[model samples]
Structures are given as C-alpha cells and as structure tokens.
Target chain A: MTFQVILVLFALFAITRTSRQYRKRKVSLYWFLLWTGLWALVIGIALYPTTADAIARFVGVERGADLALYLAVVLLAYLVFRLFVRQEETERSITQVVRQIAVQHPSKPDETH
Target chain B: MKTIALIPAYNEESRIAASVRDARSFVDGVVVVDDCSVDRTGEVARAAGAIVLRHVINRGQGAALQTATEYALDALNADALVHFDADGQMVAREIPMMLEPILSGEADVVLGSRFLGRATNMPFTRRMANRLARLFTLAISGIALTDTHNGFRALSRKAARELTVTLDRMAHASQILDLVKVRRLRYVERPVTITYSEETLAKSPSSFRAFGIVKDILKDKFFTRI
Candidate 1:
C-alpha cells in the first residue's frame, strides 16, 4: 500500500512537470506523448505489481525485480550514450564557431616582449 | 611561394616566444593560435613577431591547429603550411627538412617520424603508445605509418586545402591519417628528431588515456560522416 502511495505521488509529480513544460512550449507533442506513455506504464506497474511478474514470465525471467533492474540498466546506458554523442556534437560546433572568430579577428601584434 | 609556419600553443608562455622566433627564421611567416591560454602566450607570441590568433574558449591543440591552418590559407594566402609544436619538443632546425618535399612538389604532405630519426628521452610508455596507435591506424585507415601522433608535419597548399580536421582533441592525429587515406593525398614520411623533456611528458596524456582516445576515434569513425 505504501509503495502504491509513493508511486502515485511520483506519477502525479511527473504529470505536473510534463504539463508545465508543454504549456511553456519547451517540449514538443511527440516528446510529451512519449513521456506520458512511459509514465502510464509506471502507473500501471505501480497499481498492479503482479503485472511485472507476468512480464517477467513472458520473457522467461524468474523475478520481476530482476527484469525491472535489467530494463533500467539498458535505458540508462542508451541515455548515457546519446548524451555523449550530443556533447560531442555541441563541442564540435563550438570549436567551429570559435575557430572562425579567431581567424577573422586576430589580435594586434604586441610591440614589446 | 609564401610558406607560413603554424604553431598551436596553450599555456606555453615561457617557450612560445622562442618557438615563434625560431620558426620565423625558416618560413616566410609565423602564425600562432593561442587556444585561450591563461598565461600570456598571445602577448609573448605577438611580441616575438608572430601573427597571433586567439580563441575565446579553450579548445584543444587540434582545434587550434585547424584555426592556424585556415588563417594561413585564407589570410596569408600561403603556398605551404608547417605544423610545429609549441612546447619546444620539436627542433626548429629540422623545419626546412620537413618542408623540402612539400616545397619541391615531391609530396603533397610530409609527416615527421621520430622512430625513423631520433628521440632523446622518450618515455617507455609513450613509445609503446605510439606503436599501438600505429597498429590501430593500420587496422582502421590502412595507412601503415611509423609514427601516428607526431605533431611535426608539412603540407602543400593543395593538401592543406583538401584535408579537413573535425576532431577537436588528441584523437585528431588519428583523424588526419583517415583524411590522408580518404583524400588520396601523396604523403611521405620524413625523419625528424624530437627532444622529450619533463615538461612535454607532463603535458602528454597518460597511458590510461589511450583507451579514451581510441574510443573517441571509433566513435568518430562509426558515427560522424566526417
């Protein structure tokens, strides 16, 4: 019961945050839909913990906890990889712009050492 | 033909002036890219009679070199460009030896190979890393180079214009080999001596960081179109 209560509170918080972002035009419709779908899955699992066991059995896993841990790990790994790629792109663009500025406006030669 | 010597410096305030002075003697012009160094590297280079280009943020040596190359080509209209390290590891007297092939139109690019010449005080770890990098370059780019990460190189106008550098870090040395293969530029290995000091070794990446460089190169190969 306590687990359900905490999950419910967290789901409410996620919904509120997503709605706020949507209202501010910070998130697109596609992202909102994706995130809400993910939240819905969480709520479904929270309301019926037995569903996780069913999912585990379908996948030939013995425990739902193990399955959840595996999925979380996979998701985190993918997110981290995406973040690395994005960071690399940002750094490249920054370097390009910086190089242009450096080339175009070089400092005057100093007369004294 | 106007040959410009390019030096990328970062926090080499003590050595940059001498490097600029020495390089000016060999090339028609000297251009230094100060990569947002905290030290007075820009002022030192400028006072030494080098055209100083400043990056507002700290990129890496690769980015600075790219900037210097572009400036040399666009601003100076150079016929050839020489890539020289600013840490005083490279011998200025050998600049003409590296530039000879490029200047004479014998090769589009001339890469310096320390193994072919001489290396005084090269760390054991660095030698191993260079050998590994050479093997990796062979496997990936199919270019069997004696030295993979040597900074001393000379490129003709055509080669400099054709080669593009996108990697902004240490992995750029690997990226250049890939460009050499892709662009089909005629390149030659020139024997050049280098002196390794405690300061240069301190600036070099550690053996553990080799894995990170490999990862960056692999990522660039598989992911980036460049």
Candidate 2:
C-alpha cells in the first residue's frame, strides 16, 4: 500500500513536469502503477515462503517468484519505453514553437511589451 | 509596419472566411496558404480577399508556413510575418500586440502565450496542458517561455528568414524549437487570449487520435531527421 502511494506521488511529479495533459498524466500514472504493482505482487509471492508455495502449487510452476519479478520488470520497462519516447517527442515539439519565437526576432525581452 | 499575416489553413472552409474577415481589421494584408485542402478553404480564403495560395494536396502546416514565409519574404517584401490559426480561436487585435516587440526591435520572435497575462474562459485541462507544454519547451530549447504551444506568433523578417522548419505536421513545433536552440535564436513570449469554442471542444482528439499523434510525430521526426 505504501509503495502504491509513493508510486502515485512519483507519477504526479512526473506528469506535472512533462508537457502532456492530465489525461496523459493519468495514463502514465496507471502504466507506472501497473508496472510497480506487478513487480510487488511477484516479490510478495517470492519473499514469503507460504505465498510462494501456494502460488507455485496453484500455477504449477517449478520456478519461484524471484524469476517472475525479474522477467516482469524487464518486460514492463520495454512497454513503458514507448510511452517515454512519445513524451520526449511532445517535449521536442514544444521546444520547436518556443525556438521559432526566439530565433526570428533575436531581441532582449522588454517585459513592457 | 509592413506586416503580412500568414495563415496556414487546411480544410478550414467552415471557419476560414470568418478568420480572414476578422483578420483584415488589424493586418495590412493577409496571405492564406492552403495546405491542399479538399474543401473550399482556398476558395473561401480567396473570396475573403486574401492572397490565397492553394497546395496541390494536404502537405501539412510546416510546408504551408515555408511556402507562405517565402512569399511574404521575397514577393511581398514584408517587414514582419505573423502566423495565425484558421480555427477562429485567436483574436485579431492580438496581432498588433504580438508585433509591437518586433516593430520596436525589442525581440526577434514574439510568441503569444495563452496562460500568461490575462486569460478568459480557458478550460482547466487546456491550462494544465499549456503549462506542461511550456515547461517541456523551456527544457529542450533552453529558453524560458510562459506558453509553448500557443499557435499565434509573430517574427521579424530576419527571424523568419533564419528559420528552417522541417516537420510537415505537429512535430514542426518541436523541430522549430530544436533549430532555434541549435542556432541560438533569440525569442520571447507575449500574453495573448485564446478563446475556446464548443465546436472545437467537441472535436477534441480521442484516445486513438492522441496515440496516433505520437506516431505521426515520430514518423515525421524520423523522416525529417530532426
């Protein structure tokens, strides 16, 4: 629960810093939330012998949750990469508009204007 | 000042006429660069008494800007170029204020920021979006601005000639920023009002469209190598 709350705060900070809308923020937040949750879920199953044995028996997997956490984190990172790239592209676009405004005039801002 | 308003319009037939008519009140002349719009955008802009140049097809906003800037710079001999949206969102009076810095030789490029200065009826979602966009641009271009994606802006002839926008779509904004940053262009942001319409709000991008915008930006960035 604490991890989830921290993840939410991190998501907010990330969204506020980026040029995307809150809707985008929400999307990114969920993506991160799922990423963290899946890993946490795997960790809980692995660290706790009782939980690990029960899940392993139920899922009928020979491998334990430690391997699952590692695989999940790697896979989720790749999935999240695309989102990060898109955010960067949007940032690049915002930079372009500001540059045009900056390049054409080449004057010190007077604030009075 | 000998200012030519360069309006890059695409399939904006439904709103171009009003835009041209409203713009005539402030600008000395208007140049409408139609991006190969299949609708009556060219005809309407022309009928509204603007010097309309129609693209053979929808080439995108950057192409329109390049075409119009070339015309305004070479043929029209304009002192400054002001780019406006054909979506009927910007006010005409803002043109004079946008150019004041240029005319006074106080700045090279003046961007009209919707979030800065006085604002009216701006939606919360848009306000947040504009703020984020502004911060992103500031980080990338290393120029602090109050608003980043505000469509209304004016540039002096020198700045206009200095620009080399390569993106053929929304990514054009990003490409322009990178160029300015790399080229070290001087720029500033001015407060301007942007009115939202029910029609426009109704047409806001869907989830698919939002993701598609990302794809388009990436595709253009790769194609232009910007």
Strongest candidate by lDDT: 1
What range of 10 consecutive residues in model 2 chain B has the weakest lDDT sum? Answer: B204-213
Tell me the interface RMSD of model 2, in angstroms.
Answer: 13.0
Q: Compared with the true structure, what per-residue lDDT tens digits does model 1 show for residues A1-113?
A: 99888988898789889989998999998988888887888888888889998999999998887888899899999898888888888999999999988988886565443
How well does candidate 2 score on lDDT at residue A80? 77
Error of 2 at A32 (Å): 48
Q: lDDT at B106 for candidate 1? A: 92
What are the per-residue Cα lDDT tens digits for candidate 2 across B8-73?
A: 888789999989888878887788877768888877787786777666545567767777787778
- Models 1 onward score TM values of 0.93, 0.62
> Per-residue lDDT tens digits of candidate 2, residues A5-104?
6655665555444425434564566666565565556455534647665666567665555546556689889777766667656645654554343224
Q: Model 2: what TM-score?
A: 0.62
